[model samples]
Target: MKSFFHVIPVSHVIPANAGILMLVFLGLFCSSFGFATEPQAPRLLEVGVSDVFVPQGFDDNDNAQVVVEGIFPTTCYKLGPVKVDINEDTIKITPQAYFYHGPCLQVMVPYKQEINLGILKAGTYKLNILPDCPENRHTLSIAHSTNSGPDDYLYAPIESARVVSKERPTVRLHGVFSNSCMSLDRVVTHSESNRVVAILPIAKYENNGACLDVLTPFHKDVQIKDPLKGRTLLHVRSLNGTAVNVIEDF
Candidate 1:
C-alpha cells in the first residue's frame, strides 16, 4: 500500500517572529502612507514694524519715518500699499501683502520699506498691524524719547493681555521696547490654588551704551498651572536684573 502524507501550507506554518515582523512592516508602511497623504500648512508671511523714530519737539504735522519689514517664504508675493491709521494715541498700519499667480520656490526673503507717519505729538503711541491681510501681523510701541538729556530714556509699557489657553493656562502679552540693547531674561509666575500672586521678571529698559532709541514691538508667553478662581498678575524683567513692567489683575 502507498504511504499517504498531509500537506501543510507555508502560511499556516509561519513562525511567530515572522508574523511579528510582518505586522511591524505593515504598521510602518501605513504610517508612511498617512504622512504622505496628510495636508501641509500654508506658508505664512510675517510683517512687522521694525523701527520707529520721532524727533524731539515735533508737532502733529511732522513726518516721522517707520521702517517696516517683511519675511516671505515664497517669491510670488506682491506688496501693496500700506494703510496707516492715526487714532488718538494709536497708529495702526495694514500691509497689503498677497500672493500672485505663479510658481513659487521655497526660500526665505527679507524685505523692508520706510513709511512716513504724518506729524503728531511726542508721546507714547501704540502701533498696531491690522489683521486684514492674508499674512501674519504684529503691533509695536512707539516710545517718544524724553529729550530731557542724554541720560533720559523711555520705557515701553504693557499694552494688552489675554489668556491663550486654559488647560496649560498660558498668558499672552503685548508690549513695546524702545531700547535695542535690552534682552528679555525670563518670566516668573507665582500662584496659590486658583489665584495668581505674582509674575516676576518685569520688562525694563536699560542703557546698555549701544542702545538706539527706536520703538519696537515685543511679545511674551507665560505658561502656568490652571488657576483656581482669581486672576493672575504678570511681570517682566530684563537680563540685567531690572524690573521692566508689570500688568495687574490679569
Candidate 2:
C-alpha cells in the first residue's frame, strides 16, 4: 500500500506573477515618464522653466550650464536633487528624484533638450521635484520632455488621494466603475466596526470625477450613502439582478 499526494506545476503560478509585474512596470514607465536615464535641468526666468535635459554622463561634479533664455533670468528657480553643483557661474545637474504630489508645483517645467532614450533598466522614477506640500493638493502636470514640436512627453494632471491605514479600524465599501459611470449599486453590507475608511471614487478616465478628499466621518451607514458605494450592482428590480453576498463577517 502507498499514500498518494498532489503536486502543482511551478511554471503556471510563478510565470503569471512575473508577467503581471512586468506589465505593471511598463505601464508605470509610460505613465508620467517615471524612469529617468538622465537628469532634467531647465532654467527659468519669470514664470516658465526652459532648457531641461541632463547632459550625457552628468556626474556629481559637472557644472553643466544651459542658457536660460527667459524674460527675467534673475528669478530663483529651485532645482530638484540630482547631484547639482551650482555656483554663481554655472549650475550642474544630475538625474535623480523621488517625486510625490504636493504644493510648490504649478507650471509644466520643460526640459532643455529633446532626449532620445536608447535603453533603460527596470525601476521606478520621477522627473521633477516633489511638491513641498502633499500629493492630494497638487494639480499641475509637469512636462517631462521639452518639445512642443509634437514629440514632447506630457503628463496628465493627477489629483492626489490618500490611503487609509489598515491597522486602524475602518470600513471600506469597494465598488467597480468604468469611465466615471457607476456600474452597479452593490454596497457591501455588514460593513460596520471598521471606520468608513475611505470612499475611493476611482477615476477610470484621465480626468473628471470628484476626488475623495473630504474625510467623511467614520460611520458605516454614511459610508453606504456614498455615490461610489454600490456601483457594481444593478437595482434588485431589474432583471438578472441577483442578490449575492459580497462579504460576510461573523
Model 2 scores a C-alpha lDDT of 0.28
lDDT tens digits, residues 72-132, model 2? 2222234333343423323233333234333344554432211222222222222331222
Error of 2 at 192 (Å): 81
TM-scores of all candidate predictions against the true structure: 0.31, 0.16
Off by over 4 Å in 1: 1-61, 131-250
> Mind giving the per-residue lDDT tens digits that candidate 1 earns over 1-250?
7669878988789875897899889889988887535544443343443332222222233344444455666777656567788887777776655565456777876655555675456665666664532222323334454454322222235565666765666777666666686545566566522322334434545677788977778887877654534333333322322222322233
Give RMSD (Å) of candidate 2 vs. truth.
Answer: 29.5
